[model samples]
Target: MTLPITTTAQVRQSLLDRHEIALLDVREEDPFGQGHPLFAANLPLGRIELDIRSRVPRLDTPIVVYDNGEGLARTAGERLRAIGYTQVSLLQDGLRGWREAGGELFIDVNVPSKSFGELVESQRHTPSLSAEEVKRLLDSSADVVVLDARRFDEYQTMSIPGGTSTPGAELVLRARAQAPNPATQIIVNCAGRTRSIIGTQSLVNAGIPNPVAALRNGTIGWTLAGFALEHGASRRAGTASDPQRAEAAVAARAVADRADVRRADTARLAGFLAESARTTYRFDVRSPEEYLQGHVPGFRNAPGGQLVQETDVSAPVRGARIVLADDDGVRANMSASWLAQMGWEVWVLDGLTADSFSERAPAPPALPAPSRPVQWIAPRALADALAREAPGTTAIIDLTTSANHVKRHIPGAWFVLRTDLPQALARIPRARRYVLTCGSSLLAQYAVDEIAQATGAQVLVLDGGNQAWADAGLPVEAGEQRLASPRTDRYRRPYEGTDNPREAMQAYLDWEFGLVEQLGRDGTHGFRVI
Candidate 1:
């Protein structure tokens, strides 16, 4: 199972040459969040069989997979080959070799994006208003509008007092509508720092006349400052009026011109994509609902503000050409302007007719049916089997992911990695029958025979996996229990969910706060402030 090996030095050289390289970490997110090289993408082994093409896209792109000391890279490479990826390699000696070679390792998930946000703050002194200052303004009834620059659902989760949900790219198009008076002060906030700075700067870049500022450090900072966040907020910035839209377009076009952002018609976009020497990503910089309603043929939905904040996650190839599309030019232009400063070859796609968006984009591609036939049992049948059998006779093994296993799974399913199943079967109580399940039963189907051979048990794949079980009005339980495998596939992100401890939250902020210095020391990112 040994594949061609790539050293950390070679990976660093590729970066210096500005080559498109995906340093993929094959472990789950939990370990990935602990530490990794700055540019490494977390592509856990469990999902590699499903998401390779969509995530990496190019078959020939150089990819180096690592897993610290887990020994999962070679197995992952084999899976990549099954899916037709040609340029896959293992990191020599894993993460330890990376350190020995003097490569800098960073902690936390989405490090590239978070570090970039800090770089933006360092480069451009994006204006801000402390929670205390904002509180005083609110108490005095000042003419100010607080806008939450996160998704509507996120805004509803926790928002500043009286803040409207005006997610990223919409800042320019809807700010005027939210605050009609240019003389009035405007405040923008997000959960933490990235969206707040990016949102406030978007207004400044568009030459908006209002005195705008980010609610300093967003809701996290507010909480840190002893201010209560407003939950279940319903305020939103709806579609802009004709005059406001026209005005926003003019400002955006001007900013785009300043950023030297080129405009590409459909033909030009196609031509750029046709060039084999470079990679071109075309995305629609609009809300997901708008994109879902209708979108162009090949463009993916990448809401503008989040796109800028998560460039590495969205577009791993640093020097690739990115084409952004929007019905109105405001979102695309403003987003491209910031990306240009961040050293990307970015463009705005143009000449879209009403017909361009007449159809909705397709759902994400599904995993193909497994090549080898495996036994299948419907959710109801499986439920009945669990009740009919003695307590430990039937082992219900779930391969969905440690994260999902913790969230919810089939009531008593033991979460196990497919790779670990062969080695782990001997330890579990001998069972006469076994049932396998995952997000979809697609992957579980392939593992049925392997489990049967390893454990000498009659194995069956759950017909529709957990999704179908949940759809059938079945109750599911949640916990880190009945584990046949370690929870190593998914990282616990500090900036991820709402329930992070204060120490982890503060530590994450401090890590981000110190990133500009790290970026300076590493000297890889060619970021500039415009």
Candidate 2:
């Protein structure tokens, strides 16, 4: 007999009711890392059978599986039934449906505090502070501690007058160190809303005695309000310790921990890969340009900073073993430290490389190609189509971030953040065709690829990305003006893709095997995978 499918509304209400429900997401690591719903555990469909027993524990517990509507939910549901799970169910429309129902999704910046930071930001509001009020505060010269919640580098680049760099997580821990007086009014600011809101709230949540409020909409708002700003000291020195010394200190501290860091030889890694069959993720801790140049065939590109910031999004598999792939140990080891802190069973594959294995060595199976049609339209043709096309029946997507989307974009096009694309697709009429655009041709190509694979909708990439459109001298919009904000809130899925047990196991094994070959080819030197 087939299990029942639950609507997103039903699942959401269940969570509110605090029912004994287990929410499971089954997507690949890279996409899942993008975003997912809060409190939903990731169990990629490929490894559902192996992990369900442990994650849910109670066989009869209500289990709901979902994806971005790529038929992964049905696939996962079937797997659960085969494993004798009696109360398993599928999320009616997967992530897309949940989002259409207005469910919140989250980005996977791996640090729990960072995730909490986002939550604090989402709950933020711009409290009124008029020019007169500002004048009064300045005139009074009261003890107002202005904290810059952005990275140290960003603080140096620019900041509000009298602001000092405190970073995000450190806001609460080091608040007193910076502002010792309990009577001081603590004010946090970042480039924009996210960090400032989180930073201010962190102090409030920690029960600090001072009055804390995020500078309304952060530094942008401050400048807009005609408030003076200041920049930090230039060309600051590097962190006191060397990379190796820092790593050694981190590892030494984890000696007695269950999540201690471990390095695997080629043989050990190969055995792990041989034993597992699932979507295992291998992240190349490098820049996007480096990744595009080709490091490992299947490895995803996740820069170390973003990786650590959004760990939950990238690797949601709580118990699934993680393998870090890097040319050196510094990054890999540092990333591993963060993951270990998050309770992942992580390992670094030592001595792995593409050339180390024999030419005939078996390659991992390729991911199933996206099933959608791929259309390549020249920039001139696309501009012509947009000008003449019926606006309501067709949608143009600027898949870049808000900042880039605002700089210059196609006329009448909507800004579809990469994190919100799936849900945005659901809200858009399926009858309409979609035109996808990005800063460059490569990103647009990838967006088109994923949409086609995940949805049956007719989609096209602006052939040369935005550059092509600009080169053709078509109409463009520019300036700091804000686009209409999306009606639906951003979806945040913590473990949608990365938490698949089967995939995690497979990834771990592959890294182990791959590392062995790499070590033999290039004697381990300036390399780390975290």
Candidate 3:
């Protein structure tokens, strides 16, 4: 069947014009990972028939599918037609065709958001003072505050010789308290660009009276510029009053004065819980490790930094009330302020702890049982399938980040980031069978589950994930691309070996626990938590 194909120029123009179109790349993930058009969703062809409908609710929505060549397009088109999708079309000649036609292709670089942050730093021309600049300022006795916008752990790990730990979001709220004098110049930085750009921008955006600029490229840039970062443990924890508690106190005061913040006592909180049936999103904004150990009932683990960084990807619903659970109020309050600024109805759930409500709160949700009807294949059988079908027919999908997939992956495997799975199914060739793998078996199982739920595709999981694949003595690829840094080029202080990693860890934990408690306390009142 001759399917409708959209050209690169047309796709670019559509994006430029802000037209309502969903760009679907239907290729095995590895090739898709090598590069793809920006904002293109990946839904591998094998799963297109099932998953596309869920993501694109309207059958009439313009859905453009593309593969490496014409063969996949035809197969995908046929499947869409069989599924009764009237508006389904293909990308002419696939991605190669798009590029051949002078269309722009975007590299699926890891840390694009972090990179975009660097661009913001460049664009805003946020200031940075080198050692020489600092020396001059100090010599002149200038009123300049060198604020380290990284975590307290990082500040202790390494910071500008005289900088104080203010973290990022808190810079704006605590600026008055920390620095006091509005005339003082504020220099904010993280280990690298993200926090620095974000921190400097936050203060400037908040209309701080002081001049603010991020240290260019952060500490790495500083080092490259022949400046030195200090590396002694900080004498004390950079303690600040908890914003939620402060806000609550302010609200309490308003009860007597002009009512600004509303205070909800236990009775009010209980009543609010009884009255509301809205879908509340409870996040345990603690480390995944901590979450795996023990967390509040019904709360999903979402690290605070990652939660802030990937809010759109994580929670698509704009109006959902988000309740953040942390051990203490600091991180939760910091996260709440950012979310609130972004127009989310966010609240810090305070006070819950492993000790305080262990038995009182509901039990943790039960883990879903494995329900695969297909018997596990033997290693030899899997090897024979790979030998026979891998070269031309079978597509191995490593549902990991492109960077990790590129670094080291199953030989002949394609990269399909979990985020792009929906689009891959819509655009990749469906004639081939698929084997899903990830860093671990759990993620592989997750991919299989998502695919099964979306489409009744005959997909199989790599039993042991990447480890199993390696253990099977299957071919593995390795390259420098596989190595990923625990830290970004941007400034972020390491928490390890700091004078008080435990104390810092405890503080963060307390903040996250407090947040969960606060959310349960708030329930569905006038304030939305998300």
Best by TM-score: 1
Which ranges of candidate 2 are over 4 A from the true structure?
Answer: 1-259, 277-279, 284-305, 325-330, 351-372, 384-404, 414-461, 471-473, 479-530
What does candidate 3's lDDT look like per residue over 166-186, in tens digits? 755446446656656777877
Better of 1 and 3 by TM-score: 1
The C-alpha lDDT values of all candidates are 0.82, 0.56, 0.55
* Model 1 CA lDDT for position 185: 97
Tell me each candidate's RMSD, in Å, in order: 2.4, 15.1, 13.0
On residues 58-149, what C-alpha lDDT tens digit does candidate 1 reach at each position? 77888888888877888888888777778889888889999888888888776676787788778778999998999999989999999999
Candidate 3 Cα outliers beyond 4 Å, as residue runs: 1-187, 191-194, 197-279, 286-294, 303-306, 350-375, 378-397, 410-435, 441-460, 468-477, 480-530
Error of 2 at 502 (Å): 45
lDDT tens digits, residue span 414-528, model 2: 7664434566666554536777777764445546655665566678878878888888898889743434335222233221222324443344323323432332332211122
Q: Could you tell me every candidate's TM-score relative to the true structure? A: 0.93, 0.47, 0.47
Please provide the root mean square deviation of candidate 2 (C-alpha atoms, Å). Answer: 15.1
Candidate ranking (lDDT, best to worst): 1, 2, 3
Q: Is candidate 1 or candidate 2 better by lDDT?
A: 1
Candidate 3 overall Cα lDDT vs. reference?
A: 0.55
